[model samples]
Target chain A: MFATLACVAAMYLTPLVWMISTSLKPEAQATDGSLRLLPVPASSVVERARANYYGEEAAGGAWKPGVWTDPSVDFPRFMRNTLVVCALSVTGMVISSAVVAYGFSRVRWRGRGLVFGVMLATMMIPFAVLMGPLYVIFGRLGLIGTLAPLWLPAWFGGAFNIFLLRQFYMQVPRELDEAARMDGCGHWGTFWRVIVPMSRPALAVVALYHFMFVWNDFLAPMVFLTHRDDFTLALGLQMYQSKAGNTPWNLLMAASTLVVAPVLLLFVLAQRQLVSGLSAGSVKE
Target chain B: MTREGRENLAGWVWVSPWVIGFGVFMLLPMAMSLYYSFTEYPMLEGPVWVGAENYARMLGDGTFWKTLWNTAWYGAVVIPLATALSLVIAGMLTSKVRAGGLFQAAVFIPTLVPLVASAMIWMWLFNGRHGLVNRALGLVGVDGPVWLERAGWAACALVIIALWGVGQQVMIYCAALREVPESLYEAADLDGMGPVRRFVSVTLPMISPVILFNVITLTIGTLQVFALPLALFQNSKGGPGQVGYFYTMYMFDKAFADGEMGYASALAWVQLVLVLGLTWLMFKVSGRVVHTRG
Candidate 1:
């Protein structure tokens, strides 16, 4: 059992480990005939630093080492672009989904159930169906080349996120809404004072998931953001691979590692919440 | 306003963003796409209605058939394999291992890596000459095929990549595995069932509904796969010999690259029907196997 578990772990972790290992290798060592996981030891400490850590131009201007100094891959700029998009989309998704879910869960009305049911059915409509029409719409609006189309739809509330939030909102006590209402609170007041305060965990779950989704989103960005300056990290990573081709394996891996690090960091920090949030949202619902 | 009137108005007010959004983004686009499907719209000019021509053209489009086959082959293989792998991993974790949490985390971390980034990593790993995968294979004395360059190996490569992201499915199974009643296992044991027998008779049935749910959802997801292949292939040209070319990739190429908006819209509708049909089929076929709680 232990051996089996170790093998599984090795399988899962190898690509990631190789990514980091390849990122540290010099260009020759990266694409060389050798298959060492680490850089060979240099004769001197300065040479080792130059070969493995610091960027250096080897003899005859053949190779440049290190990811950051490679200059072709702009990690920080893409990171900024990704962060901005994620911030807008995640905030919009949480607030809008929570509001929409409030309507579906907390409010009572004649058409509420019917509308919410239709909304749930919308979850089944794949994004593939939306791709062509949305492109046309965005093109018509002159937002095709901008990041607006990529993040703006998030403000409308997606069916899946709304469903997740509504399920959680339903579990909140009805007495809270009534008590807030009895205190001369209107629907907005009751929602802000009662529901929002009580649903922090659910809200966090929605926010985290949305954050990851927007951060990891490749297709929308691929379709909408045409210019290199506006490329999100995921898209930028692809652009890097294509522009560089198979030559710069080390830098390619480095770029991939940089793009993957934040999400991995978030997972490491909040694996429990992430796991429970996703499982509860899907399986329990 | 009357009490009911006030409640109804407030409800609409609260959901107005989604309602407005649903109309503009979902309903309007769907209508436009349906309209576009029957017409010729190339983005350079207005749509000209041609009435089923786009759909008919799809029949003879060889690339369309190839992409459909590729997508179906991917779904057929990846869905079941991923499901079983997730379930087995979940089973292993639940079997009282030390540091099970760490092991689970190790497995789950890859799922968090964006599909685009995973493609990059795997592209490097699947490299013919210097990739770690081939290196590892060499250590085991088995020669690794040039994965991305060959049609058969490319499909296998994508499946392997897809399997890596089964962490989400694994978590769902783990949660479901925990919900399986211990008494069922005890009863099976009392009836002379060993570990294998107990797992087969008790655990599998108990978790069957979750399995069904995961399978359906996975089916929906895998059928629409795009980003990974988009990242993996050179020039985003789909995999070697178009073996990794999926349905969405084709739709994307038609709409954006080929500028055949009408045909692309028609393809989108076909994909929608196919996905809905397959999901429905799963519900029907798996109905007999899925055990619901009383």
Candidate 2:
């Protein structure tokens, strides 16, 4: 059992540790092939980029074909772009999803089930179908170049998140809504004061799901985001993938490692909740 | 009447955002796609009505047929393997193993790696020469085929990569597995039923609802998978001489690369309708199997 646990732990931890190690390695030593898992005199960060050896002939100037290594680290900017898109998308998803879920869960309108069914049905619609139209709409809206393409959809009661929250809301007793109404609490007031307060675990699940999803999403930003400044980490890394020359894979891995860590940590924290929520069909409603 | 009106209004207000979103994001696009399916709509030019040309063109186009076949094959093969593997793994992990929680986490973590990242990992892992797969094969005195470059093997490659994230499905099965009552297991044990018989009679029926959900969802999800195949063949032009190319990839290429916006839009709509229809069919067919508790 201990051995099995160790193996599993090792499997999960290895790639992560490789990412961290590669990120910290001075580019020269990183690429030098002599330095395997451990860093070669790897204590410092800045000096690692421009070493005297390993074909770097100049100090951050034009490089010759065989040997010029322009060692520059854009890790910080990479971090920023990733954070902005992920933050916006996750936030938008949570608020809008909760609102829609609130409507589906508690409200009693005609065509409610039909509308809900339609929304649920859309979940199966492969994004392939939406790709053409979404691009065209965003282009028309002139929202293509910005992060609006990323989060605006969420502003429209994202069905997945809404569904998730609805399932959770259904699990909660109708008595809560009744009691809140008895206290003269309006729907918004009830949602904010009573339901939302009680739904912290599920909300965390939603937030974490969105955070991980948007953070990891490769296709959306690849299509919509045009500017280098607008690059989310995933898209930015895709750009990095297409980067010419030796393709500093270790550094790319580093950026990817960094990009996935916070999200992974969040997942690790909420993994159990996510599993239970999924099984319980909390969002399936 | 007044109370009913108020409740209806409230419901509408609550679900209003979804309606708005669905209209703008989904409905509008669908309408335009239907309109454009008849027209020659490229991103560069305004769409012009061309009648059934696009659909007709799809019929004659070998690549389209190939893409459809590849996607169909993927759905047929991978769905079963992924489902069966996940069910088995979920059962194994959740069924009173020592350190089950750790195994559960181990299984699920791969899905969280993001499809893009997983593809990148597999590129190296599936590389012909220095890849871990080939290395492992060499150690065992066998030569490994280049996974992504070979046609017959490339579809297999994507399927294998897709298998990595079977963890999510596994997680689902695990959750559903817990829902199976212990009494059934106890009764089976009392009757001296073996693991195979016990699982067949008890576990399968108990988790049938989830099974239905997983199959339908998995089909839709797998049908639309773009990143793995896209990423796997990033430098190679397309998937294993387009042998591994699936429907989404075909639509993506048409829309983004080929600039056949109307055609792509039509294709997209077709894919959506197909998925919806299949899901509805599965729901209908599985009615006999699924136990809906009142």
Candidate 3:
């Protein structure tokens, strides 16, 4: 049983470890020659690449034993773009979801169920179908080639987050609301003092989940942000992979490693909360 | 016209953003898209009422039918496998395993890898000559095909990437599994039933609603698939031989790339009807779904 568990752990973590290992190895060692667990001695790196790549050439005369040029890739810029996008989108999502959730959770009104149903139904609609229409709309608004399309939707109330928070808010006892109201606390005051303060687990889950989704979302940004300079980390990694003049695998790996670690760390930190939320607060119980 | 009315107005005020956005972004667009499906506009020019030519074109496009077949084939293969994988894994993690939380977390990690970065990772794994897959195959004394370069193998790669995101669904299953009643398990044990029989008699019936939910949702998701192929194919609109052109790709290319908005809108309406039909079928079949409220 222990061995099986160990295998499971290894299977899950191996790619990540491989990513980090490939990142640290000198460019020549990981990509060109026999991909090794340990980096080849730095001195033998160029020789190995030459013998492996050039010696296998159709004509030896046509081969050039290109010297190893450890390319310094622009990892920092890609990492920055990722951070900015996640920050903007996640912050927007948290605020928007919380406000919308408050309306659903605490406040009472007519047509509430109808409004909630619309949100739920939209959730069922696969986002892929909306892309072309959104593109045309954004283009007409002159919002093409910008980050606004990626994050602006969050400010209008994302259904997934609204549902998540609304579900969690229902779990909070109504007596708190009654108590706050008895103290002459208005709706805003009651929400700030009672509901928001108490729903930390749900809020944390919301923010973390939002961060993960937006941080890893490449397709939306890829479609919307067209400029080379505007690429986010997800798209930036691909750019590095296909860079002109002999793409550097090591540096691309390096950038990917840098980009993925923070999110991975965040996931590990919040795993319990996230998984608990999945079972407990997710799916609108 | 007292407390209820005041609270009602406040509630509307709070939710007005969502209501307005939903109307503009989803409801209005959906209705407009329905209208435009009958026109012959390409966004560059004003739409002219053409009634059903684009729909007829879609039927005859050859590519459209092929894409639908591919999307359906993919949906057919993935939904069952993914749903089953999630259920069995969730059962394992929840019932038999002690490291339930850790295992759950590990499994969900792949869903976090951005689609593009994961695509890069997969390309390396599937690299024609020196890929890790081919290298692994060499160790087993069997030669590997070029997974991405070949049309069939590219489809296989698409399926694998889609399956990798099954992590999220697994977590959802894990959530659902916790809600199952222990009394049923106790009843199974007391009846001297074996594990398999116990699962059939008890576990399967209990979680069937969640299973149905996952299937219906995932099928919808798989049918509308686009991003994976777009990432994998990169610059080539579809994939090798347009094999990666799921119906969504055809629609996207028609609207944006080919500047044929009216045609694409037609395709979208067709899809909307198809989806609604399928959803209705699922709902009709959902009578058998066992909802465990506990």
Candidate 4:
């Protein structure tokens, strides 16, 4: 059992390890078919890293003047665009979903159950069905070629996030709400002072999930954003891959590592929350 | 006004965002999509009504049929393999292994890599002459096929790529496995059931509902797989002989690249029906097999 598990682990880890290893080598070494995991002589690692990241210009090559003139991808700009989308979408999703969830779980009102049922049904409708008309809608609204199409819809509650938060909110003791009400608190005050404070873990889960979603999303950016300057990291990586005919495998791997690094770091830090969130989303009571 | 009326008003105010969002983003778009599916609406021009013309054209369109077959084939192969592989791995991890968390992390980490990045990594690994996969196979004195260059091999390459991200399903399976009661195992032991029999008779039934749930989610996900193959082939059209060209990719191309909005809307509707039908079929077939606890 131990040996089998070890083999499975090695199988899974090899691609990631190879991604990093290939990024450290020079172009020739990367495609040489040699099994060596590092650059030959290993002293040129820093030089190779600089060339791969900042382009040949960093290694005593001719400097280009304009952004379009430079052959190297503007990775930092793409990272900035991706971060902007993530920040806007994650914040909006968390706050809006929490507000909507409070209505579903905390308040007793007519037709609430029916409305919640409709929201759950909406989750089953795949995005493919919406992407067509959404393109036209965004074009008409002049949101194409801008980042608004990517993050604006998030201000409205996502069905899944709202459901997850509602599930969490339902577990909050009703007595706390009563206590707050006795102190002359309305629904807004109770939600702010009592529910939101207590449900931080669940809110964090929603925020993290949405952050990763926006970060990894490729198709939406591909369909909505037209300008190369507006591209997210995922879209930029694709553009980088296809732009060069004989793209240096080493540099490509380096770019891939940059795109994957932060998500891996986040995974290491929040594995528990992510794992529980995954189970919570699928495994029902 | 009565207190109930005031509470109702408050509820409407609180949930208004989602209500408005659903109306504009979902219901309105769906109605428009259905309307546009029946017309000849190019992006640059207004819709001209063409009753069922787009759907009829799909019947004779060779690429449409090819892409549909490719997508269905890919989903049929990927879904079961991913589910079973993850379930087995999850089973192994749950059986009191030391360093289980470490092993689980190794499995789960790949799912964190974005689709485009993973596609790039796999492209290098599956390169015909110099890739690590071919190099490893060469160690055993076997010649490796050019993965992304041929028809059958390209489809096989995509299947392999799909299997790499089974880590998420594995994590979910691990959680489900841990939830199975210990007393069932004891009962199986008392009945002198062997390990394999114990797993089949006891563990499988206990976690069958989770298996069903995972399969449904996997079906929905795998059917809409777009980014990985798009990034892998690096073309709006798919790889060699269009084997990697999928339903969503075709829809995307028709809508955006070709500006065949009406045709693409028709394709989208067909995909929606296929997904709904397959999901319903799974539920129907699994009605007897999936064990729900009382």
Candidate 5:
């Protein structure tokens, strides 16, 4: 059992380890016909300035490779664009979903159940069906070739997040709503005074989930954002792969590592919370 | 106004944003797409009503049929393998092992890496001559096929990548596996069931509902797989001979590359029906097998 588990663990982690390993290898060694995880130490420490890339070489410098200098793929711009989209989309999703969830869980209303059901039903409607019409709609709004189409719809409540938040909200005692109302709080007032403070963990889950979603989303950004300047990391990586030059496996791996690092770091730090929250989304009571 | 009336009004106010957005985004587009499916609405031009022509054209469209077959074939192969793999892995994780949480995290970390990045990583790993996969196979003294270049191997490569991201399902299954009562396992032991029989009789039935749910959802997800294949087969749209051409990929190509919006809308509608219909079918079929606690 121990041996089998170890084998599985190695299988799972190999691609990731290879990704990091390949990223650190120089162009020559990266493409060299071997599956070595670590770069071999060069025999000589002398600076081979003339033969080296960029015409500048210190001791052992030629062995080290950096993805930053890739002339074709602008990693910084991709990172910035992706960060902007993530920031806007995550904030929008958290706020909108929470607000809408308040309506579903905190209040008793005539059509609330029916409308909420509609929202949940729409969750089953795949985004593929909406792609064409949405493209047309965004094009009509003159939002094509911009980041607006990527992040704007998030301001509208996503059905899944709204459902998640509503489930969280329902657990908050109804008496809190009543007490807040007794203290001259309206719906907004009660939500601000009572629910938001207590629902911090739930809100964090929603935010983190949406953050990862926006960070990782490809098809939407691919369909909507056209220009090189607006390319998110996912699309930028695709563009990098599709570029006409000889594939720089090292730089490509570096680009991939850069794309994956932030989320992987967050997951490592918050594995407990993320695993619970993610499984909670799927596993029923 | 009565308190109930006031509450109703407030509810509307609070949910107004979602309501409006749902209308504009979901309802409006769905209605418009249904119309577009039956029309000649290219992006640059207005719709011209062409009753059932776009849907009818799918009958003769070889690519449409091929893509649908590829998608169905991919889903049929992937869903079961992935589910079983996750179930087994989750079962292993549930054993009284040291550092189970760390192992779980290791297994799941791949899922957090964006699909595009994962695809790129796999593309390199599936490279014909120098990929780690082929090299490992070579070490075993078996010749490795040019995975990305050949039709069958290209599909196999895609499925392998899909299986790697089964971490999410594994996590769900792990949670479910943990929830199965220890009492049940003890009871199975009392009945003198062997390990395999114990698993089949006790553990399997206990988590059958989760299995069913995962299968249905996996089916839905498999049908809509786009990004990984797109990124993996960047030059080919789909890989050699469009072997990786999936339903959504076809829809994307038709709508964007080919500028055949009306036909793509038809494809989209079919995809929606296929997903919903298959989900419904799974529920109906699995009703006999899925054990729901009364």
Candidate 6:
């Protein structure tokens, strides 16, 4: 049983290991078809790593490599663009979704049940159905080719986040809110003083999930952002791969590693919350 | 105002962002898309009404049918394989294994990789000449075909990539498995049932509802697969024989690349109907099989 489990784990992880291994090698070693997992001649490891990332010309003051040195496919710029979008969208999504969730969970009013039901149903409407008209709408608003199209809609509450937050808020005792009200707190005041402070972990889950979503999103950026300057990392990686004809495998892998490392780091840090949150959200509701 | 009226106003005020967002982003677009499907609109010009032409044209478009078939075939193969594989992995994790958390983390980490990065990683892994996959196969004296350059093999390569992301479902299954009653297992053991028989009778039925839920989600997800194939092929043109083309990719190409907004709107409507229909059908069919607790 131990041997079987080890093999299953290896089967799942080898591709990622190979990706990192490929990224560190020079172009010749990467495509040599040899079975070595490391760059040949360990003495040249640092030089090869420098060349793969910072470009050989910059690292050695010599001839240029291909796509890695191209200024337009700037990795740092793409990272900045992706970070900007993630920050704006994640903050907006968390705040708005929490407010909407508060209404659904804490406040009892006419038509609340029906409105909540409508919010849940909206989750089933696939993005494919929305991309067309959304593009036209953004075009008319003169927001196409800009980052506005990517982060603007997130200012509104999303269905899944609202549902998750609502589920969390429902567990907070109504007595707390009533006590705050007894102290002359309004609904807004009670929400901030009582509910928000208690739901930190759930809020973190929503923020992390939305952050990952914006980071990983490709189709929206691909459709809306026409200029290369506004491309997110996901789009920039594709642009690098396709635009760099006969792209060196090592540098491509390096770019991929750069794109994947942050998400992996985030996952490692919050593994418990992310795993539990994902399973709980799906299975319970 | 009455107390009830005051509560109602406050509730609406709190939820106004979503309410306005729902109308503008979802309802307005859906209504516009439905209207656009019946017209010939190419963004730069005003829409010209053309009754049923785009939908009628779709029936005769070979690429439309081809992509539809490709997407359907992908969903059919991927949904079942991913479901079973995840269930087996979840089963293994639940059986008192040492270092189980380490194993679970290893399985779950791949799903966190961005899709574009995942595509690049798989493209390198599936490379015909120097790919790790082919090197491993060569060790067994088996020759592997050029995956992305071939027709049938491209689809198989895609299925393999889809299987790699089944860890999310596995985690869900693990949670559901822990919720199963130990008394039922003891009862099965008292009846002299073996491990396999006990699992089939006890474990399977208890977790059937979660399975149904996961399968439906997978169906919706797999049928709309776009990024992996698009990145794998490195273009919307698709791989050899258009085998890598999918329904949404085609819709995207028509709308954005070819400027056929009306036709793409029609395709989008068809996709929405098909997804809704498949979801409804799954729920209807699984009514007897999914054992939900009261």
Q: Compute the DockQ of candidate 3.
A: 0.41
The CAPRI-style docking tier of model 3 reads acceptable
Ranking by DockQ: 6, 4, 1, 5, 2, 3
Between candidates 3 and 6, name the one with more favorable DockQ.
6
Query: Compared with the true structure, what per-residue lDDT tens digits does model 3 show for residues B33-92?
Result: 766778887777777898888888886788778888888888888888888777767777
lDDT of 6 by residue, B1-294 (tens): 998899999999999999998998889999989999999999788789999999999989999999999999999899999999999999999888999989988888888889999999999999999888998899999898998889888888999999999988989999999889889999999999999999898999999999998998899887788898999899856798999899999999999888888999999999999988999999999998888888
Report the C-alpha lDDT of model 3 over A1-285, residue by residue, as the tens digit: 545655665666556666666655655566663657656676664544344222223365654221122223345555677678788878887877888899998998998998888788777665555666777777778988877788877777789789888988898999999999999999888889998999888888888888888887766776688776667777776666656534555545556665677788887687777777666644445
- Give me the TM-scores for chain A across all models, comma-separated: 0.88, 0.79, 0.83, 0.93, 0.89, 0.95
TM-score, prediction 4: 0.97
Which model scores highest in TM-score? 6
Q: Compute DockQ for each candidate against the true complex.
A: 0.74, 0.48, 0.41, 0.77, 0.72, 0.80
Residue lDDT tens for model 5, A136-232: 9999899999899888899997999998888888889989889998999988898998999999988888888888999989889878988898899
Per-residue error (Å), model 3, residue A144: 2.0
lDDT of 3: 0.74
lDDT of each: 0.85, 0.74, 0.74, 0.89, 0.85, 0.89
Retained true contacts (fraction), each candidate: 0.80, 0.54, 0.39, 0.73, 0.75, 0.74
Better of 3 and 4 by lDDT: 4
lDDT (tens digit, per residue) of candidate 2 on A1-285: 456545654654555555555555655654453425656554554444333122334557855221122234344565687778777778878888888898888777899989888988777766667777788889988998888888778777677778778878887888888899999998888899888988888887887777777877877877788777787766555555666634555555555665567767877777777676666552142
Better of 2 and 6 by DockQ: 6
Candidate 2 C-alpha lDDT tens digits along B121-178 = 6665676754556666777799999987888777777777777677778878887887
Give the clash total for candidate 3: 0
lDDT of 4 by residue, A1-285 (tens): 888999999999999999989998877899888988878888887866666666455345675222222346688789999999999999889989999999998888999999999998787677878988998999899998899989999999899999998888888899999999999999999999999999999999999899989999988999898898998999988988899776778878988999999999999899999988988887756
Tens digit of per-residue lDDT, candidate 1, span A35-56 = 6767776334355445543467
Taking all chains together, the TM-score of candidate 3 against the true structure is 0.89
Candidate 4 regions with alpha-carbon error over 4 angstroms? A55-72
Off-target runs (Cα >4 Å) in candidate 5 are A42-66
